[model samples]
Target: MEKVELLEAVQKEEENIIRWRRHFHRYPEVGFEVENTANYIAEHLEEWGLEVAKNVGRTGVVGFLKGGEGKTIALRADMDALPITETKETDYQSENIGKMHACAHDGHMAILLGVAKVMAFHRKFLKGSIKFIFQPAEEGPSPGGAAPMIDESVLEGVDYIFGAHLHSLYPVGTAGINLTNMMASTDNFSIEMIGKGGHAGLPHESIDAIALVFRMYQEIQLMVSRNNDPLEPLVISVGTVNGGVATNVIADKAVLTGTVRTQSKNIREKIIQQLEDKANFISESEGGRCNVQIERGLPPLVNHESSSLMVKNAATKVLGKEKVFILEKPNMGAEDFAYYLEEVPGAFYWIGAGNKEKGMDYVMHHPQFDFDEKALINGTKIFIQTLMDVWN
Candidate 1:
């Protein structure tokens, strides 16, 4: 199909796509607890006469559409929501309390479903198999959802893969593509400071954990500034701190949790080691004990140049060349889609979701975050057109 025809076809299904997106949005599930979302994906794919597989990587659904001889391609969409209260007072606001589609995974699933419907209808024109992956837990669960899905052989025989993120940072109808390092690596760390407790009035009798924590936080900033290279992009954020039970008593223990983001693996490693060493040294010197736990998260998303070129070409053919935006710098946010790219050579691009006039400018993961619904149709069309461009 021609680009216009493809977009028109997707536009024709706009209402149905909206219905799917809203339904999933209302019943938002977090992490690996996406049973209803998985069921809905499976039913839709099966209804379209595609072979559906469930229970892969726990609550993940995979649908396959086979065609004549060629390379196999896989398209992925995350189905997990965030653990946040819905603040967007829309008719389709999340019905589940303390859970919401704050990250726009509902739209992601709908776009992939829209593409699956198009691929099913045009299966005869396809020269290769297309796998639609509805993955769970992209947000985080220790090792994340991508590695488990891959370990379950979700990418078997898959030669290439494609995925897209709805970015609130960009305007609707515009797409962003990067040829290398589109996102950073994320790792988390926690520190527990153990000290002696006594009356707050008796300072010399007890080790002051609150004072120690404040010093530790400041020292961490200094460590990054002095130890890391001036040219490297690195960030250390201490987000949570908890201690003390009562105002009259000096806290016996303090807990601190934070995250580190870096552009390269070498810097990531250096930051982690420095964090541990600094925390340990400070706590011991203060006559207190410290335990640090560092958990590794997703690696940086490196976009393959060839795959990105293919995506740009396909997108230009579908949308106008002027619609595509070449990003100058990678965002510090991390994605588990990097795991899929580790096994298969592919690129992950962003679809713009910002529209100031429509009041859709909230950043992702915010309680009031929302996107322009028109991006759904545009994303679906681009995916279908890219498949045709790649397969033909």
Candidate 2:
């Protein structure tokens, strides 16, 4: 289909797309418990006469639309929500208390469904096969959904894969495209400091674990700033701290939990080692001992050059050259989609969903985050164009 006709077709289904998004938004599920969400998606795909596979990676769903004997392309969307209560007062606000689609997965699903709808109707014109992947637990449980799906051979025989994240960082009508390292690697660490407990009034009688951890936090920040090269991006942040139970007593133990984000593997390894060493040194110097635990997470998301070129050309064709934004820097946020790119040549891009004038500019994971619904159509059109550009 031509760009104008394809856009008009998506516009015709705009209301249904919003309806599906709101339905999923109201009943958000987290992690691997997205059974109902997966069933809903599978039902739609099956209804469209596509071959469906349920529970490929525990709760993920995959739909195959085979048009001819050619290369297969996969389009992916995450199907899990965050563990946050809905604070928005909108009518479609989450009915599942304490779980919300704060990261715009609902929009992602809607856009993919819109693509499925368009492609299913125009299957006769398609020259190849398309796989629609509804992945679960992207918000995370260790290595995340992508890894498990890959283990199940989700990328088997796939030629190219494509995915997009909806973001508020850019205003609506712009798409962020990058050639490499679109997101950072995420790794988490925890430190436990142990010391002698005593009355708060008698400081000399007790080794202060709280003070040791506090000092270690400051030292870790300094280590990141002074040890790494200025050109390399690295960040270490302590997100949680826990210690004493009583105000009048010196705590015998304290724990610090945080995450490390870096674009360089060597720097990531160096920072992890430095963090453990620094924590141990600081605690031992202060008459305490420290234990460290690091849980390595998803690798940095790097966009393949050929796949990125396809995305850029597709976006430019669908939305014009002015609407496509070539991002100069990658985001510190990490995505499990990195695992998919590890095996298959693919690119992950971003769709602009923020509209400041509409009061829809809240960042991801925020309680009040939302987007202009029109971006769903924009994303669907871009996805369709990318598929056509690739398969033709």
lDDT of each: 0.88, 0.90
Candidate 2 segments whose C-alpha is farther than 4 A from its true place: 1-8, 196-207, 244-251, 283-288
Per-residue lDDT of 139 in model 2: 94
RMSD of 2: 2.4
For candidate 2, the clash count comes to 0
Query: How well does candidate 2 match the true structure in TM-score terms?
Result: 0.91
lDDT value, residue 20 of candidate 1: 94
lDDT of 1 by residue, 257-335 (tens): 9999987888888888887887788778878888899988889888888989888887777668898988878889899
Error of 2 at 70 (Å): 3.2
Candidate 1 regions off by >4 Å? 1-8, 195-212, 242-252, 286-288
Which pairs of residues have clashing backbones in candidate 2?
A: none
Cα lDDT over the full model 2:
0.90
